[model samples]
Target: MTIVAEPQFHVLAVDDSIIDRKLIERLLKTSSFQVTTVDSGSKALEFLGLVEQEEEEQQQQQTSSTSGLSSYHQEIEVNLVITDYCMPGMTGYDLLKKIKESSSLKNIPVIIMSSENAPSRISRCLEEGADEFLLKPVKLSDMKKLRPHILKGKCKDQQKQHQKITCSIDITAAPSPTLVAGSASKRKSMEDDTLAPQRTRARFSSETLTVII
Candidate 1:
């Protein structure tokens, strides 16, 4: 029998401190994740193939003659982003906002790490769409929390695809005319049943994030 190894998850780690960057890289590697470390949040955006639209427009106005055409293409699919909350130029909160605001990158999981255990800041980050917030000096145990979030992201994408497929099948595989006429009320009930879970999920997501710090 041939055995194949599972593909490693790719993570983008952003921090201003070289020591912390090295530490995170080492930890993630030891946890069997493929890690890319950047020294700044802006660089993280660039690595993710994103730029503020306003900044790009300003650059175009200032240097249109000197520069060629621009592209906002993502070169890699990063499963997760782990960033330090405090940085020189763009704080991790700002980076988190950028990622969540982007249509293409919004689905990727983002984790914020801070040395300070500020509840208000944690609440703000969670409200801003951070998947997980970790207090500084992240441990191997914290690394375990990461896999669930990543798998959740993947499951969301799969659910969307499944929904699409189900919709298509329902449209094409219509019930027999006799059955449709006789079971109209039953069909309505089934439709209601199908939609109820979706509404429940929406409500469940609105619930506050559990603080892991």
Candidate 2:
């Protein structure tokens, strides 16, 4: 049997301090996560493909003016976002709100870190949908909280995908009264109904299912 290597989870770490950014990057790498560090929450948003319309328009203009220039955003999946709570311009709480507000990116987990142990700040971050709040000078022990949030996000994504698959199967199998379709539609629907389960089974083998469960 050929052993398949597990894909590494990607993390986006946002911090204004260069020292803190390096430290967090090192800690995340040591924990076996693929890390991408950004200096500000705005930069983090850009990395995650959540750029504002004005900036997007500017990038488009720049790309048009420059030959062979391409502006690509977020080519990889970011499993988690760990940001410093006190960044200039866009704070971590602001970043969390932006993530939570977005339909496509809201499901990704976010963690907030700060040097101050203010109760109100912690509560506010958690209330605003931050998965965890870590104190500054984050330790390896604090890294343990990261995995659970990533796994939770993964599970949620899988559940949504499964639901979509099930819905597709149901729609193809069920007969619609209002629709006036020919044999070709019926045949395709039958094919979909027949093949959906097999495709799902192939995608999630016994071992994969076991691991997920």
Candidate 3:
């Protein structure tokens, strides 16, 4: 039997410098990410929106072709976004803010790569919710550090979705003679138990536990 590897994750890279954009694109391609490079922030935004629309249309076509069942195949998966902070018309900050505000695009992780190493600039990017920041002349080793965090975030999101499905199953799988007999009470108790913290410890919990143990 022949096994095929899954499609690589996509990353949209935006930068004004031709050399910088090409460098980032090459780096991402070698690292297993399918990179799409755009010269300016405005072009990046246009490409993003266009790609989303095309995906939706493709999904609709696929559904109609079958018995209205949604297809599992993904044409493109844009899981991460990397952009330079200094662009002409729309700066990286502006693009980041736009992405954060859009409901459809807000969940995509964004990394700000820039040469501006000033404290204020870096602080502002963090404050505006950039997931990762890299100084200009990015190193391959530095890019590797961000992979774990990005993967962790993806795992957490999957876990949350699984939890929701499990809760729904539990609620619907009530085994009782009476239709309404233990359902509501069981749900309430479950809700409370779910909300309760798993552990309780003092302020210096780790240190105290280490010393006592």
Candidate 4:
């Protein structure tokens, strides 16, 4: 019997309210994902090992580190980031922007949740690279939407890897010898079919009548 391994997706849930954090954690775990909850955006960044400096130099300097989060908020390998829009320190929108800008963590899918459904806030988050925006009190049904974004991120990563591998190989190696031979054989067969049959002498036309003037 082949035992299939289930993928474990880790989620970082950020909210200022402990109750909300608990609720989101329960929702995510119910959907079969590993969950990590944080009380504030600053703590969330700390867990991710990100430096929270608002300067360009600080951001660049932090991202230079090989191992953990930097000033640019380089993301860890967490599959998803789901955060409340309203937070005490760094807002979800801020975290979303930092994650989107970081080269290492930009591919991870991000979701923003807000108690108030402001169209402008939703639009801004979407424009800044938030994959989905959920209203406050996210339901179990919202879990379904999360999977698609995660799958899309995984597919994109796969495509990038495949592209890199393809580019490193020789383009001349694309046409195999067997494929070329088969193509040539097919062309030859087509030529044979289009050619007209050779003209033959009229059957039994041996008696030729010559007109004498």
Candidate 5:
């Protein structure tokens, strides 16, 4: 029997702060996720194997052009993208919007981390399709919330397998030929009893018969 290997989830971490990048890297590695840390959104997109500015440029030139840029990121599939909300050149929100707009990359989950606890900012991130918003200096506990979203994909795959198995069992669990035939025979017998001609009792003429009179 071949042993199936479990997939290791890879995460992309983006931050302009060097210290925070190191911290996030260590925490993610400790949690057993394959981690890649980048200094900016441009590098993060580069790590994802996306062509810089070209994808956006192409989209602007041709509204419906689907495929032109090559993704180096496809080699190691990234299950999640976690980025700092505030960066110098391109902000996390900008990156999130780019990822979401990309037809090829939009499915990846994006989590935003910010030092600011502004409710309006958080609401904006959520509205922009950020999966989770984490307060800056993320903790191990916050990492726990990250797993469920990645595992959701696995759960859906398992559910599909379960449905297939259930359908097979239902098909196999059907009544046997003998049992089916017996039921059919019983039904026919009942139908014959209900529809068969009934015999009536013959009535004798008491005093009205000529011979008797």
Candidate 6:
């Protein structure tokens, strides 16, 4: 009789702020992900290299372990990367680019989280190949909304492959014009810092997670 072990899914979170790192770690811990965090992009890159080396060694030792030759098959393999956009030396964008360009690490999904809400900044990050984006002050609801998609292992290449559907429909038919206008007005009001107290609470419903930032 033989017993087969399930492979563990590993996640790497990179952030410069200790508090933010801790928060993300806690959030991921609450979820099903096994997360490892680093304080710098450079360190994250080094850690990625180490993971690859360890994976190579593991592949060589897999047969040995199955034959009861050694007890060294407990290493975890990283499958995802979460990073902050703003960092000291190598920015998250730069790090993402490096990872996407590398053959060994290109398959890993990279999620970018940042406080900057500039549309241009978010657009640039997405254009540069970020898997997903999360705003700062992350809430539990937002994390839940992102988890399913992240866990699905969908990368930029996969998204591009699915972008051919070009059907447009009038949204007015689905919702009342008054309601739409009111929602738009409320969103505009929330953009003003003076209406900080009137900010709408984050809402979560059972829906497919496919949000881009």
Best by lDDT: 2
TM-score of 6: 0.57
Candidate 2 ranges beyond 4 A from true positions: 1-4, 53-71, 163-213
Those runs of model 3 whose alpha carbons end farther than 4 Å from true positions after fitting are 1-7, 50-75, 163-213
The model with the greater TM-score, 4 or 6, is: 4
List, residue by residue over 106-183, the lDDT tens digit for candidate 6.
667788889988899888888877878889977544554443444344334345457542211212122322111112
Estimate, for each residue in 1-213, the C-alpha lDDT of model 4 and write its tens digit.
Answer: 111122456788999888898899988866557788888877776666555455445555556433324533444457788999998778999989888876656887899999898999999999999999999899976876776676567667667656443211122123322111111332343324223243111111112121111
TM-scores for every predicted model: 0.66, 0.67, 0.60, 0.64, 0.63, 0.57
Of 5 and 6, the candidate ranking higher by TM-score: 5
Lowest lDDT 10-residue stretch of candidate 4:
199-208
- The lDDT per prediction is 0.68, 0.69, 0.60, 0.65, 0.65, 0.59
Off by over 4 Å in 6: 1-8, 50-75, 154-213
Candidate 5 stretches with Cα past 4 Å from truth are 1-4, 52-73, 153-213
* Higher-ranked by TM-score: 1 or 5: 1
RMSD of candidate 3 to true structure, Å: 15.9
Best by TM-score: 2
Q: What's the C-alpha lDDT at position 166 in model 5? A: 27
lDDT of 1 by residue, 147-200 (tens): 667767766755755644222112213332211111224235333532353322
Give the worst 10-residue stretch by lDDT in candidate 5.
Answer: 204-213
Please write out the lDDT profile of model 2 over residues 20-128, one tens digit for every residue.
9999998876655789999998989878776775565465454421111224664577889999999789999999999898766788899999999999999999999
lDDT of 3 by residue, 10-127 (tens): 6888999999988998777545466899888777766655234446566555542111223353335566779999888999998998777654556678899989788898889888
RMSD of each: 15.2, 14.4, 15.9, 23.0, 26.3, 12.6
Query: What would you estimate as the lDDT of candidate 1?
Result: 0.68
Candidate 5: residue 51 lDDT (0-100): 57
lDDT for predicted candidate 6 compared with the true structure: 0.59
